[model samples]
Target: MAWKFRRRVKVIPGVHLNFSKSGISTSIGVKGASVTLGSSGAYLNTSIPGLGIYNTVVRPG
Candidate 1:
């Protein structure tokens, strides 16, 4: 079996918030958690307590 190494990239430190008549969004990331809203939908990505990482996405039906 081959072993692979993953590189960690540092995210810009700060909290971001956006508000509009259509929708509302917010994100806070220092070292771990990250979130955003895109054309497809909104998503939150973060590291779980035990699990490696968790990602959730929500879109309109």
Candidate 2:
């Protein structure tokens, strides 16, 4: 049998969350900023006025 997936929507601006048979994840974006968290790990993405884009990741050991 195939696993079913589910998703939840929020009214908040620049925010999203989802869930599935594999795992759960979330994403947020606001004011040129973004962040994501999931089973793979945690990720952060952002851009500054002049610093350009920045990306980072964190995983379990």
Candidate 3:
């Protein structure tokens, strides 16, 4: 079994800070679209709030 720890704090209306065992990440956007930049890398995230459909793509550096 593996254990994971993660916490998220909303900085503002469309901004958030994520904390985890790996490191920290900043997420910016609304419910359906967002971008995350962190120690690991950058990512583009999109989703439909009610449809349970979502996608994440790695942003090329």
Candidate 4:
């Protein structure tokens, strides 16, 4: 089995900082829509708050 570590801290109402074993990332937006930029790449994250449906798109740099 593999273990992973991740932590999210809210910087403000719609902003968050994400920390993980791999690296750090930042997320900005409301519940259903947000953008995450990290060491791997930039991603567009979207989801239905209550339905548990979500999608992620990688943004070309």
**Candidate with best TM-score:** 3
Weakest ten-residue segment in model 4 by summed lDDT:
52-61
Which TM-score value belongs to model 4? 0.91
Candidate 2 local lDDT, 1-61, one digit each (tens): 9667788676488888867777778888775577778878777766675667665666642
TM-score of 1: 0.35
Model 2 stretches astray by more than 4 angstroms: 1-11, 18-24, 48-61
Q: Compose the digit string of candidate 3's lDDT tens values, residues 1-61.
A: 9999999999999999999999999999999999999987899999999999999999765
lDDT to native, each model: 0.57, 0.73, 0.95, 0.95
The worst-scoring run of ten residues by lDDT in candidate 3 lies at 52-61
Clashes of 3: 0
Better of 1 and 4 by lDDT: 4
* Candidate 1 C-alpha lDDT tens digits along 1-61: 9665433333445666655444555566644566666454666666675666776556542
Q: Report lDDT (Cα) of residue 56, candidate 2.
A: 62
User: 1-61 in candidate 4: lDDT tens per residue?
Assistant: 9999999999999999999999999999999999999988899999999999999999765
Clashing residue pairs for model 2: none
User: How well does model 2 score by local distance difference test?
Assistant: 0.73
Candidate 4: residue 26 lDDT (0-100): 97
